[model samples]
Target: MNEFKCKLCDKKIDATPYFEVHEWSYNEHGELLGTSIFYCDICYSKYLYKEI
Candidate 1:
């Protein structure tokens, strides 16, 4: 696990802060590549949809 900061509000938010909609790109082996990270509570509505 790693620490993540909100790109919008500049807040230091970890997984413990509770992000419901976590989006990322991965390889066929299910390894994490990169993420479209957003910090809004209603993150789904805020960030653009990513093609998985």
Candidate 2:
């Protein structure tokens, strides 16, 4: 089996239902750059609950 770790807290993710945090950057010419990070359930929930 493969192992995954949460980017926020570095927690070992051992199951499904985790979240993928994706971001994209666009240039003025409309070119795009993208990245993805993993987040565990607890960290994801806390991230969602934070005040902006």
- The total of clashing pairs for model 1 equals 0
lDDT string for model 1 (1-52, tens) is 6555555555554553433465666789999865443334534233332333
lDDT of 2 by residue, 1-52 (tens): 6465555676766665444566777869998866444446757732221111
Q: Candidate 1 — which pairs collide?
A: none
lDDT of 1 at 50: 32
41: Cα error in model 2, Å:
0.8
Weakest lDDT window of 10 consecutive positions for candidate 2: 43-52
TM-score of 1: 0.32
CA lDDT for candidate 1: 0.48
Error of 1 at 26 (Å): 5.1
Candidate 1: which stretches are off by over 4 Å?
22-52
Worst 10 residues of 1 by lDDT: 43-52
Q: How close to the true structure is residue 32 of candidate 1, measured as C-alpha lDDT?
A: 81
